[model samples]
Target chain A: DAGVTQSPTHLIKTRGQHVTLRCSPISGHKSVSWYQQVLGQGPQFIFQYYEKEERGRGNFPDRFSARQFPNYSSELNVNALLLGDSALYLCASSAYGGSGNTIYFGEGSWLTVV
Target chain B: QKEVEQDPGPLSVPEGAIVSLNCTYSNSAFQYFMWYRQYSRKGPELLMYTYSSGNKEDGRFTAQVDKSSKYISLFIRDSQPSDSATYLCAQRLVGNEKLTFGTGTRLTIIP
Candidate 1:
């Protein structure tokens, strides 16, 4: 089966601009989560959506938000971006029932802010 | 201190040698442990996953979790060049799906 997929593989933005990254979860998967990985750092959790409900949220600022669609796809939005917002935004998907409910990740959207 | 700690190694080893990577965590509430392998500029691929504590083996890969010490490890036996990649340890607390990840260790198996 195809794995989770993310769009806008790369993007360039400037300070004060907004950006939206998208993700399509794997077939049969119901949960979608977003993470941000700054250079030299591990992925930091952002938001998780299950069955279209916001399940969990991380310590990100109000500038960051996300939503899951009826199709189990998701979008992560960042407002008034800052240069520090430059990072790889990853999307992961998992099913409710599984041995470990492993969260499989997508290729990620590389966002570069100037 | 971070919830999860791992050495960000650019560790190099000869092919066919044994390799071990580890992570230490401070959150005892974390119950799900996992190891992921990621190539340059790519998303991490799940290599191993375990619950609570104990060891799990798959092919030449072994994952061990020690709840008492809040430690976890991944070992590769008879390692191959293809095994060269960044190994990341991740954990999630019981009843929650959010994961905390290590900084990752980059391994290179030289031929």
Candidate 2:
């Protein structure tokens, strides 16, 4: 089966610009989550949407937002990007929205801000 | 202090040797633990997942969790060159979907 997939495998932006990253979950998955991974660091959770509803959010600022569609795909939006926002944005999916379910991740969208 | 701590080792090991990776966390609320392996520029692939404490083994990989000490470990037996990559530890609390992750440990299996 196809794993979680992300779009815009790589992107380059400048300070004060906005960027949007997309993700499509595994066919049978119902929950989608977003994470930010800085170079050499682990992925930090950003947002999770289960059945198109916001389920959880991480420590990211208000500039980072996400939404899941009816088809279980998700999009992460960042406004007024900063150099610190340069990182790999990962998307994960699970068959269920619970903690017990296994989460699968995508290759991620690499974003660079100058 | 960071919630999770892991040594970002550029650890080198010979093929067929035992490889062990570990992480420590400060949060007691985290009840679900998982280990993921990632190749360069790729997404993490789940290698092990466990809840509560104790140990679970899958094929050549073993996962050990010590909730009392807030420590978790992943051990690979008869490691092969294909196992060379970054290993990451992740945790989530019951009823929560957000995961907290430790900085990955890079391993190199010398053939």
Candidate 3:
């Protein structure tokens, strides 16, 4: 079966610009989560959607938002981007929305803000 | 203190040697422990998952967890060059979906 897949493998944007990254979860998976990884750092959780509802959110600012579709795909959007926003955005999926389920991650969308 | 603490090692070892990677957590409430291996510019891949305070071995890799000391470890035996990558330790609470991760330790296996 195909693993979690993300789109816009890479992109660059200027400060104050907006960008959207996409993700398609593995077949039969219903939960999707987003994380941001800065250089030399581990990934930080951004948002988690289960059954198309927001289940959890991280400490990120209002500029970051995400939503999941009925098919379990997800989109991560960043508004008024800042240089600090430059990082790899990762999407993870699991069979369900609860704990104890194994989560699989995508290759990630690399975003650069100038 | 950070929720999870890991030694950011650029640890280099010769091939066929035993490699030990470790992490410490401040919270005893973390019920699930996991190790992830990530290559350069790639997402992390789950390596081992452990729930209790014991050792779980898979092929050449062993994951050990100690709740009393709040320490977790991953051991790689007969390491290979293909094992060169960053090792990350993560933990999650019983009902929480968010995984708190430590600063990863970079490992390089020499040929």
Candidate 4:
């Protein structure tokens, strides 16, 4: 089966612009989470959705938002992007929103804000 | 202090050498420890996972978690050049969905 898949593997955007990255979770998975990884750091969690509801959110600002659809797909939206926002946006999926389930990640969408 | 701390080593060693990577976490509530391997321009792939305390091994990779010391480790034996990548240590609490990650150690296995 295909793992979590993300679109627009790479893109460049100007500061203050908006960007939307998409993700399709594995066929049987019901939870989708978003993470941001900067150049030299490990990924930081952004948001998680399960059954089309927001399950958890990280320390990111209000400018960052995400939603999951009925099919268990997800979209991460960032508004008023800044140079600091440039990073690899990762989408991960798990069997459920609870603990003990192994989370699988996608290749990630690389966003460069200039 | 950060929840998790790692050496962030650009550690290099011979292909046949044994490699050890470690992380220390501040929260005792973290019940699950994991190791992830990430190649450049790619997302992290789960390498190993361990719960509470004890050692779990898969092939050449072994993951150890010591809850008493708040320490976790990943050991790669008879390493190959294909093992060269950034190794990340992550921790999760029993009821939390988010993972706290270390800065990651970059390992290079030279042929």
DockQ of each model against the real complex? 0.69, 0.82, 0.76, 0.76
Full candidate order by DockQ, most accurate first: 2, 3, 4, 1
Clashing pairs in 3: none
Clashing residue pairs, backbone N/CA/C < 3 A, model 1 = none
> What TM-score would each prediction reach against the true structure?
0.97, 0.96, 0.98, 0.98
What are the per-residue Cα lDDT tens digits for candidate 1 across A26-104? 9999999999999878899999999999999999999999999999999999999999999999999999674567789
Off by over 4 Å in 4: A97-99
Instruction: Write the residue-wise lDDT of candidate 4 on A1-114 in tens digits.
Output: 899999999999999999999999999999899999999999999998999999899999999999999999999999999999999999999887466789889999999999
Q: What are the clashing pairs of model 4?
A: none
Question: B75-99, model 3: which lDDT tens digit per residue?
Answer: 9999999999999999988867788
Report residue B69 deviation for candidate 1 (angstroms).
1.1
lDDT of each: 0.94, 0.94, 0.94, 0.94
Per-prediction TM-score, chain A only? 0.97, 0.96, 0.96, 0.97
Against the true structure, candidate 1 has what lDDT? 0.94
Cα DockQ of the candidate 4 complex? 0.76
User: What TM-score is obtained by chain A of candidate 2?
Assistant: 0.96
Between candidates 1 and 4, name the one with more favorable lDDT: 1
